[model samples]
Target chain A: MIAVIDYGAGNLRSAVRALQHVGAHLQVTDRAADLEAADAIVLPGVGATRDTMNALQRLELASALPRLIHAGVPFLGICVGMQVLAEQSEEWGLHPCLGIIPGTVRRFPSHVGKIPQIGWNQVMSCAATPLLAGIPDGSAFYFVHSFYVDTLDPLLVAGRTDYGIQFPALLHSGNVAATQFHPEKSGRWGLHLLRNWIRSVT
Target chain B: MLTRRIIPCLDVKAGRVVKGVTFADHIDAGDPVALAALYDREGADELVFYDITASSDERAIMVEVVEQTAAQVFIPLTVGGGIRTVADMYRMLRAGADKVSINTAAVLHPLLINEGAQRFGSQCVVVSIDARRVPRSHPTDPLRWTVFTHTGGAGRATELDAVAWAKQAVELGAGELVINSIDADGTRDGYDLPLLQAIASAVGVPVIASGGAGTLDHILAAVTVGQADAALAASIFHFGTYTIAQAKHFLAEHDVPVRLV
Candidate 1:
C-alpha cells in the first residue's frame, strides 16, 4: 500500500484523486505507524516551505521521514514537498528544511519571465532513473512555482527544465524520487508517471 | 519556457454544465464531468468551473461534480462562482480544485484574498473582477471603468476603479487576476482590449482575459494586443463554434506560444 503523507499542506485532495484514478491502494495521513507500515510513500504539498516544514515538525513527520527513506522504501515528493527535502530555502527569508537532500531552494530572479512561473513547460530527462523510465525527454508538465532547487551533487538530478536558468525538475537517489511540478495535475503524462512509481513496487 | 494558456470556462449549475456543450461523444450535454473530460482531451491548457448554482442542494452537487471532474481530468482546475470565505475556498480545494476564484466575497471583504492566499499559497487564490466601462465623471480623465460585484443579476457597482482594484488585490495577495468585461460579455464582438491591457500592464502577475470572446482572432488579440496570459471564453467553445485545438493552432500560427497536443 502507498501512504501519501499529509501534513496540512494544501492540495492533498487532488493528489489523492490522482492516485485513486491510477488505481493505487493509498492512504492520506501523517501518522508514524501508517508511514512505517506502507511499502511505499508519497509526500505531497503546496504553499510555502515554511508552512510545510512547520506542519511536518508539528505532526512529527519531519524527523520520522529520514528513517523511512533511509530504510530504502520508495518515496516521492511533489512541489513544496520536494523543496522541503532540501537543506534550506530562500523564500520569506532563510528557512530550515528536512536536509535529506544536499541543496538549497532559491526564488527565480526578477529577470526570469514571471514570479510564480505558472503554466505548462517542457522537462528534459537528465539521468536514467526508474521514475522517468517511460516518460519522454521533452514532455510538458504543469508547473506553478517561483522557487527552484540548486543541488550540491549533480548525480542526484534526474530531470532538468529551463525557465531562466536550468533547474532540477526531477531528482532521484536510490528509492527516493521527487518532482518540482505537480504530476497529479499534469494530464496523461502525470498519470503515467504515478503508474510507473506504483509499478516499481507492486 | 512557460507558454501562454488557453482556458475553457465551464459555468456549471447544479450538477450540470450550463449552456449545454453539445459534443458528439458526450452522452449528457450538461454533465460537468463529461465536458471537462472533453476539454482535457482537446488539449486545453487549463480549465475553470464556475459554480453558478443558487440552491444549497445544488451547491452540494457542484462540489460533487468538482470532485468527479478533478479525478477524471488531469489538468489544472480553477473553481469559481460561489467561493466567499477561506473555509469555502478550503471546501473546494479539498474537493479537488487547484485554485478558487473569489468574485463577490473579494469585493466585499478584501481580506479574504489575503486570508486565502496565506492559507493556500498565492497561486491558489484568483481574484476575478467583473468590470464595466461607464461615462467618466471627471472632465480631465478619459478612462472610466468601475468594478462591479454582482453585475447582470443583482448588480452592485462600487467606487473602486478596475485598474486600481487589480493592483490592490495583488498587493493583498491575489496571485492572478481574471478580468471579465461586463459590457462585452456574451456580445461575441471582441474582448475589451483597453481594459485588459490596463490591468495586465498594472500588475506583474498573470492576468486571464474573460468574456466577449467570439472568434479565434479575438482570442489571438487578447494575448497579442490585450497582453493577457490566458483567454477564457464560454459560448464559442460550448456552442461548438471553435474547438480548443483550433484555438491553439491559431495561437501557434500567430506566434503566440501555446501547448498543442
Candidate 2:
C-alpha cells in the first residue's frame, strides 16, 4: 500500500482521491509506522513550509521521513511536501527543513508577475525520468505556491519551469522524486504524471 | 511562460447546476458533478462552482457537490458564492476545493480575506469583486467604477472604488482577483475591458476577467487587451455556444499563449 502522509495542512482529500482514481491502494495516516510498512510513500501538502514542518515534527514523522527516503523507499512529494525536502526555507524568515536534499526554498521574487504564481505554467523536462514518461515536454501544470525549491545539485533536476528565474519543477534522485506543481490538480497531464510515478514505483 | 487559463463557471443552486448544459453525451445536464467531468475532459483549465443557494440549510448540499466533483475531476476546483466566514471557506476547502472565492463577505468583513489567507495560505483565497461602471462627472476625468455587493437582483453599490479595492484585497493576502463586470454580465457583448484593465494594472496578483464573455474573441481579448491572467465564462460553455477547446484554439491562433488539449 502507498502511504500518504497527512499532517493536517491543506486539502489532502484531493490528493487522496486523485491517487485512488489512478488505481493506487493508499492509506492516509499521520503515523510513521504506515510509512515504514508501505511499499511506497506519497507526501502531499499545501500552505507554508514552516507550518508543514511544524505539523510533521509534532506528529513525529519528520525524523522518520528522511530516514525512509534515505533507505531507498520510493517517495513522492508535492508542493510544500517538495519544499520541505530542502535544507531550509526563506518563507516567513529562515527555517531549517528536512535536509534530505541539498537545497533552499525561496520565495518568487516580486518581478515574477505574481507572488503566489497561481495558475497553469509550463514545465519543461530537463532530464529523462520515469516520472514524466508520457507527459509532453512544456506541458502546463497547475502551480499554487509562493516559494520554490532551489537544489544545490543541478543533475537531480528532472524538469525546470521559468517564471522570472528558471526553477526546478521536478527533482529526481535515487529513490525520491518531487514536484513543485500539484499533479493532482493539473488535469490530464497531471494525472498522467501521477500514474507514471505509481507505475515506476510499483 | 504561464499560459492564460480558461475557466468554466457552474452556477449550483440546491446542489444542482442552474443553467441548462447541452452536452450531447451527458444524461443529466443539471448534475454539477457530471458537468464538471465533461468540462474537465474538454480541457478546461479550471472549474468554478458558484453555490447560489441562499439558506444555510442548503449549504451542505454544495459541499456534497464539491466532494463528488473533486473525486472525479482532476483540475483545480474553486468554490464561490455564499462563502461568508473563514469557517465557510474551510468547509469548502476541506470538501476538496482547491480555492474558495468570497465577494460580499470580503466586503462586509474585510478581515475575512486576511483571516482566510492566514489559515489556508494566499493561494487558496480568491477575492471575487463585482463592479459596475460609475458615470464620470467631468470629461477630463478618467473612467471610474464602483464595487457592488450581493451580485444578483438585490445588488448594493458601495462607496469603494473598484481599482482601489483590487489593490487592498491583494494587500490583505488575496492570491488572485476575479473582476466581474455587473454591467457587462449576461449581456454577451464583451467583457468590461476598461474595468478589467484598471484592476489588472492596479493589483500585483493574478487577475481573472469574469462576467462578460460572449464570443471566442472576447476570451482572447481578456488575456491580451484586458491584461487578465484568466478568463471565466458561464453561459458560453453551459449552453454549448462554444467548447473550451475551441476557445483555446482561437486564442492560440491569435498568438496568445493558451493550453490546448
DockQ of each: 0.77, 0.85
- Which docking category, incorrect, acceptable, medium or high, applies to candidate 1? medium
Candidate 1 Cα outliers beyond 4 Å, as residue runs: B136-141, B152-154
lDDT of 1 at A124: 87
Report, for all candidates in order, the number of backbone clashes.
1, 0
Error of 2 at B129 (Å): 0.8
Candidates in order, TM-scores: namely 0.95, 0.97
- RMSD of each candidate relative to the true structure: 1.9, 1.2
For the second chain, the TM-scores of the candidates in order are 0.96, 0.98
lDDT of 1 by residue, A69-166 (tens): 88888889999889988999998999899898999999998888768898888888888877777777788889999998888989999889888889
lDDT of each: 0.88, 0.91
Q: Candidate 2 chain A — worst ten consecutive residues by lDDT sum? A: A110-119
Off by over 4 Å in 2: none
Error of 1 at A176 (Å): 1.8
